[model samples]
Target: MESVFTILVLLTTVGLSGFVTRVIALKLPLPLIQILLGCVLAWPGFSLHVTFDPEFFMMLFIPPLLFADAWRIPKREFFRQRGAILALALGLALVTVPVIGYSVHALIPAIPLSVAFALAAVLAPTDAVALSGIAGKGAIPSNLRHILEGEALMNDASGLVALRFAIAAAMTGVFSLRHAFLSFVMIAVGGLAIGAAIGWLSIVLSSWFKKRASDEDPAAGVIMMLLLPFAAYLSAERAGCSGILAAVAAGMMMNYQSLRADMSIVTRLRIRGTWGMIEFVFNGMTFILLGLQLPHIIGSALIAAEAQGYTHMVVLIGYVLLVLMMLHLLRFGWMWGLRWLARRRRQRNATDLAVSGWRPLIIMTLGGVRGAVTLAGALSLPILLPDGMPFPGREMAIFIASGTILCSLLVAIVGLPMVLHGVSGKEDGLAAEERYARIEAAQAAIRALAETHDQIKVGLDESATVRVADCFARVMDLYRRHLEVLGADQTADEMARLDDQVDIKLRTRGLQAQRAELLRLRRRQKINDETLNKLLAEIDLAEAALFTRSRTV
Candidate 1:
């Protein structure tokens, strides 16, 4: 009962934070607001005690969130930017682990080198979710955002795997670099292959069910879809592989499967809306949980520091600041070196690079914000070694990880807006692509209508054929006008624009009338609730379509 109550409270808090963020005039990011609310909830008067379980948290929240991100990211852009993503995700992890490990050890000799490396490993993965919340929608250039998103998706596994090895080294007091490398390669490859196979198998089974089942309802399919990430994660972990990468691979496979599958519109929309809500709730809960843990972690660390002959909280804070500074410095230098090499290669007529400018480099550096994963990894550290001795620097590591997450969020919240101000995001040819798609679809519709009309006219009486032809002509003219609008001269363009305006107005007004009549019928008992609801839904969808088209035009 207590566990259930705690969950209810957390859910309510998550929902209320969304409301508060909107109601407040400060315009703070949602994650920041949720974290603050969490801190408030952690007060003694609240009596809100919840245990933190790292493995469960990762399994519960991380897989679906990562899957959603992978599913949504443009596959072409992800592949196109693979080189940069791998460099940051894998190569940078390799670099950051050692550099940060040595730095942490040098600063606090009390921490063993292995433990320091563990801390560094956990901090390696960036939180693109937090970055997006801080940066706001469409704030970063699209290309840079893709790269950042890809890096975040891939680095989680790398970081966690490194942490696992670090923990092993700390426990056994022995380490093998070559063996770790081989294990990482096997784990990563095996996870990817397993995830892809599972995803493909799910698609095949779904298709089989669609053929065998009589009902068209999408509930069963939606439920299966929701379970996919968890299944992938658990399966890979059981196989001694990287579950994070498995979830990511499964998500990527989902994108490909969706493109090829002939799914109902209802199923697509339902899946989209469901996942949107899941992403929101999970992300909010993750941050709030972080906030809930902060006071205890920091207070305990401060007390431990005092016992160790350090008297001030500032000393611990200084360590966080110093570590954060080193991270940014390393990120900036790495990116700058990549840019220089690309520039030199471009001079040799090799190829053009996607990311350019020092400002973007700075934005990317600041965008590398840490979040829940780092804290979870830190907290997951074992409390006792094989010799029955307490784990060295566990409290300090957790405190530093928590502090780093907070500080990184604060820094990006303050720094990103300043850097992004007055900077224009580069156009990624979306408008041109949209225009081309519209023209092609319109042409196809015209062709299909013409063919259908010919078939129908051949079997009808002259009068019926005339009526049928008239109906088809009216629908076909709409498509023709759309095509004309797409490829119009200056004068024709003005006329087409006016026609679109008048058409949109008529359609919107008609939809509004339909909705009004629907409600009126229900009020007068002229229609059953089910009938009214079904009709109203159609009307609402029409209105939404009109609104979307108006905005697009």
Candidate 2:
């Protein structure tokens, strides 16, 4: 009982810290702060004896996080940037490993080339969580954001495969480029096939379930979406393929199909909220748990370095900083070269839209912040090699990887906003377009309502029809009056948007009144719990619809 209570308190504290991040993020980046807080809480004085198990950690965290990211991303746009994404995910990661490995071997003569390459592979995958945060709110260009997201997802697979090959070569003293290539292709393709199959199965099963269930069974739909990522990941892993790729592919497939499905608006809203909250909780838990593991890792690393006869821990720290510098240099050079090549290709092809400027290259370079994936890879390293000797440079690999993660994170947290300043967000243009469309949609809705008035009146009784007509008349009046205030030449989309906001405010006033009345009835005991809940639900649904409609503008 005491153990249970202690855990409850600890988790609550961690969750509360996550919530506090939202408020403090304006001053310090939420990701940096959360990680720092985690490290601090890992102190022995806290009596937190956390253990690190790589396989278990990956199984717990990777699937849902990747799925949420993929689900939210725009499928069509992501595929449009598929070329750039593939280059970064596969080509750039492949380049980074050898270059980083070469540098590591040069610095630390004790570490074998293969082991260093393993370290390189550990660092190869960009931390998806950090990338997502750095690109949060889409402060960077949309095209670059899409590439970063896609690269982060796919490179986890590529880097892991490379890690496997590096370890094999280290253990056996034999390496074959051809075998590695074939193996990578098999793993990637297999994962994709498995994931797509599972995704289609999920959709079919969901359709079958919905056919039998009543309209109120949104839980059934939400459960299906929640189960999909785990199914993709586990099945792929069981098949000896890449679980990360499986989860990502499954998410994309599900997202594409869900977009085309004729799902009810309420179910869609519920699923969005449900999945959104789940992702938020999962991210917070991952970082907080990562913090709990810091103490043991840092201590072991220092001991290992001490055994090497280093005078001060500063020597190990120096190696970490050097590795970090190498990573940044390699990343910048790769992105710049690729961007230049892309521009040359575009010019040769005579494309109308001029190629993107250097900002994307700079942003992508700066955005190479590492996060949970790097940590997982480093921790996942086998404690002993095939010959039973302590894994060569294993401690250094973990330490270097952790230091690189912090460096990348601090750089992103401090640098992203500076680079983003003075740059315009595309949100302005999108919001404007959305507003114009919403105005047209409202006009159409009003006309349709008028046309169906006769049928609506015939179906309803006297009092009900009168109330319905009064509501319809008011809504129509609002739209007509709002549009009359707009310009003739569409001079400003913002004008219509502001007017739409005004319409939302007017609708919200009624919702507020309904809410107050519902609460009052409950307080007076004039209604049973079920009756009060039903009335409150109707009001809640109305407000939700109104909120969604307003946001369309």
Candidate 3:
């Protein structure tokens, strides 16, 4: 009962945090707001405490969130930026683990080398979720954002794997480079293969069910979709593989399947809305949980530091700052080197490199903010070694991890805006693609209508055929006008665009009037509740479609 109550309280807080963020004058990011609310919940008066189980948290929160991100990321852009992503995700992890590992050991000799390596490994994965929250949506340039998102998706697995090996070494006091390398290769390959196979099977089964019962409710399909990430994560773990990468691979496979399948429109919309809510809630809960753990982590670490004859809290904070600075310098240097190599290979103008490189480098550096995953990894450190003694520096490591997360968020919160200020927003590059798609779709509709009309006219009487033809012509005319509005000629395009805008406004007003009348009918008991909802849903879907078209065109 207590566990259930704790969950209810957390959910209530998550919902209220959304409202508070909207009402408050500060305009703080939602994650930050949730974290603060969590801190308040941790007060003695509240006594709201939830145990942090790192493995369960990873299984519960990480898979679906990573899945959603992978599903939504632009596949072409992801592949295009694969080089940069791999450099940051894999190569940077390689560099950071050793460099930051040694740096941490040098700063705090009390922390063993293996433990320091573990800390550095956890810190290696940057949180794109936090980056998005702090930077605001579309605030970063499109290309840079894609690279960041890809890096975040891939590095979670790499960082966690590194942490695992470091932990093993710490517990047993033995390490082998060859064994680690072979294990990593097997884990990554097996994870991707398993996830893809499972994803493919789910897609095929769903398709079969749809065909077997064409009129079935979409709810079952949606439920299955919700379970795919968990299934992938669990399956990979059972196979001694990377569950993080498995979840990511599953999402990518689902994306591919979606392109191939002719899924129902209703199912597509339901899947989208369901996943959006899941991402929001899970992400909120993760951050809030971090906040809930903070006070305990900091207090315990401070006491431990005092015991060690380090009386000043500033010393610990200084360690966090030092770690953070090392991360920035290393990231900056790696990025600069990659660019220099690319320039030499491409023979690009030095002037172009000089003009355009620094801003993005800075943005990427600041955007490398630590988040929930780092905290989770830190907290997951073993409480006892093989000798049954307390694990060395566990408390300090957790404290430092928590501090780094907060400080990185603070840095990005302050630095990103100053960096991005006064930069003119670019027109969405995909607008042209959307317009072209709309035109092609409209043309296809017209062609289909004509073919159907020809087939229907053959079997009908003259008068019936005329009426049918008239109906078809009216529908076809709508498509024709859509095509005209998306015209290629400059002057005609401008005029048609204005005319299309007027048409949309008129349609929007008509929809509003219909909705008002429907509600009026329900109020006066002229229509039953069922009838009202049925009509209202239709009206809402229409409005949604119109709103989407307005935004794109």
Candidate 4:
């Protein structure tokens, strides 16, 4: 009960801090703010020792987060960049482990090669949420942004797999190249199979439920949507496969399946909003937990080291930074190798190939943002190895992981701003691309509504005919104005004003008519209160979407 209560309070507090970060607008990043605040809360006087269980944390956080990310990514873009994402996510990670592992072992002889590889694997998973978040604000190219996001999404499984094998090697004192390679292939393929089966079942089930669903009950569809990620993860784990990849694959399937589900627009919108908040809390709480543990780990390490005549805080931090630098160097070299490989194959459109010169490479290396995953993996290390002895360099390992994570984040949050100042072309290009995409999307809706309007026109009375025409006409006009604005040479502020004006006109004429008709139907007892409310809610959502689109591009 206490733990639950603590979590609730922390989430509430963390949420407020996030809000505060937005309100303040130009200070530190929210993750850093949360981490710093967490450090303060971790002060001895504060009795909040927020603990975590590795299995529980992975189960609770990883699936939903990865699922949401995978679901949201553009399916076409993801697959198109599949080779690049895989190379960086899996290939680079595989390389990073041995390279960083060797570096760590060489830098600090006290830490075993196996443990160093474990730490390296932990750090290899770049949770680029923060980088991607700010990248949307401008600076990073759209193609680059896709690469970052894709790599982040797929790399979790690779990192986890690496960590697993590294741990196994550590415990048994044996590292088998062929055996590990076979295991990787098995886990990945098996996870995909399981996830695909689950995904197909979900789609079929959701469709059947939709046939019987109503607004109030919705045939338990939303519940199933929430349950699917957990189902994928658990099932995959049981089958000794990559649960992370399973959840991701399931999410990717659900993304398209959702289009086929006969769900209300309002319901879908509600799901997005709910998941948004859930992710906020999950990521926030994890980062806060990380900060809360950091000081304690450092203190513990220092005390133990002092007694044993080992290195203290300053030396440990320097060593961690050194290893961090090596990770960047390794990434730099791998990136060049990728560039060379892409050139050899004439892969012009690949993200890494598109990246010219060493400047982007350096930026990308620095931009590889590591966060809660690194810290969590480090903290989750077993207290004792398979031999029932204390894990080697446990304290130092935690410190190094924490420090490296901080550096990665800081490099992105602090350094990227300075680097990106010299670069703004991507922002403008991204905006134009978005405007074009939005126009295309709206045009699609326009086509659908036109077909619907035409089909129903022949059977309807004059009043219904006019209403049907207006439905399609209003949407078509919205798209027209959107395309017009994109071609205009007006300032952003002027364009925004035009958007607002059009949004108001559309809401006042189209959505308002729908609401008025619904009220009239209710008054005449032609429609029940429930049906009227549902219709009204749908109108409200349409109005929301109209204004929302205006803001997005």
TM-score of each: 0.95, 0.90, 0.94, 0.86
Tens-digit lDDT track of model 1 for 78-159: 9878878888999987899999999999999989999999999999999999999999888887778888999999999999
Model 2 lDDT per residue over 1-553, tens place: 7668645755675577667767763766556656766777677687655566788878878898888888778786677677778878999899988999998999988788998999899898986576666546757766567678788888999998899899888888999999899989999999999988998888887778777876666886788788889989999999989888999889888886667556777688788889887877677667766666666678887787677676557877888889888887887777777767767776522221124676666678887778788888888777787778888888778888887887788878777888888765565656677669867876897788788776778877889999989987886776675565443546455676677788788878988998898889889998888988888888888888788767555
What is the C-alpha local distance difference test score of candidate 3? 0.88
Question: Which pairs, if any, clash in model 3?
Answer: none
TM-score of 1: 0.95
Error of 3 at 513 (Å): 2.9
RMSD of every prediction: 2.1, 3.3, 2.6, 4.7
lDDT of all predictions: 0.89, 0.78, 0.88, 0.79
**On residues 1-553, what C-alpha lDDT tens digit does candidate 4 reach at each position?**
9888777768776877777777785777777878877888788887777776778888998888888888988787788888878889999988888888898899899999999899888988988766754444446755666677889988888888999998888888999999999999899889888887898899887777667755445436667788899999999999999998899889899887767545666567778777888778877877777788878877887887688676565687788778878888888788778888888778877654455776677667777888777777887777898778999887788888888888877777777777666775355655778878877876787788778778889978999888878877876776666666655657854675577576677665888888888999999999998999888987888778767765654
RMSD of 3: 2.6
Q: How many residue pairs clash in model 4?
A: 0
* Tens-digit per-residue lDDT, 1-553, candidate 3: 9999999999999899889988998888888888898888888899798899999999999999999999999998888778888989999987899999999999899899999999999999999998988888878877778889999999998899999999999999999999998998899889889888888999889878887985847899999999999999999999999999999999998997678657877888888889989998998899899889998888887787687666557788889998999999999898888778767677333212222548878988898999999999999999999889999999889888899999999899899999888653343666678778888888888888989989888978989988997899877766776887788788877777776788788989999999999999999999999999999989999999889878855
Clashes in model 2: which pairs?
none
Top candidate on lDDT is 1
Ranking by lDDT: 1, 3, 4, 2
Which ranges of candidate 4 are over 4 A from the true structure? 23-26, 133-139, 214-216, 308-311, 422-539
User: Which rank order by TM-score, best down to worst?
Assistant: 1, 3, 2, 4
Instruction: Flag regions of model 1 displaced more than 4 Å.
Output: 305-311, 347-355, 426-428, 488-491
